[model samples]
Target: MTLPPELSPEHWITHVFSAKAARQGGVIRRNLRDIERYVGRSAFEDELKRRGYHAVENAGQLIIFCNQEPIRLIL
Candidate 1:
């Protein structure tokens, strides 16, 4: 289900990065521009660090891995 467009990035991220979601090996994909505009790059990185999660960007899409495991990119 799509979230309401009016939802703030902070609230959206909070929901996507929940402990339950993380435990289930959840992955979230978001628009890079929206994230950078609403959350700021530094704050987003800090949040990832605090949660021990990881993320990567490609083609204007930000993909977050809600786990602390090492990520390998297979091309």
Candidate 2:
């Protein structure tokens, strides 16, 4: 799934749930511009953790893990 251009960090939680339920592995692309609007990257990451996602960000991309399985995510 592509990240919504204007997604707020709170709304991002929904996407995480959906992706996890779908078991859709492989790159889920996101826009860095969208991410930059988050109040704080650490807070956003904390929220992700609350919803059972583990992510690593690199050069405007994210590698996500759900249930300990890698999900190729780009942000």
Q: Output the number of the lDDT-best candidate.
A: 1
RMSD after CA superposition, every candidate: 2.7, 5.6
Best candidate, TM-score-wise?
Answer: 1
Off by over 4 Å in 2: 1-7, 20-29, 69-75
Candidate 1: segments with Cα more than 4 A from true spot: 1-12, 19-23
lDDT of 2 by residue, 1-75 (tens): 566557766677566446644365433444454555643566656765775666666678765555555556455
Model 1: lDDT equals 0.80
lDDT of 1 at 14: 82
Compared with the true structure, model 2 gives a TM-score of 0.48
Per-residue alpha-carbon lDDT of candidate 1 for residues 1-75, written as tens digits (9 for 90 to 100):
666778886886686666565668888777877777667778888888998988999999988898888999999
**What is candidate 2's CA lDDT for residue 66?**
50
The deviation in Å at residue 67 for candidate 2 is: 2.0
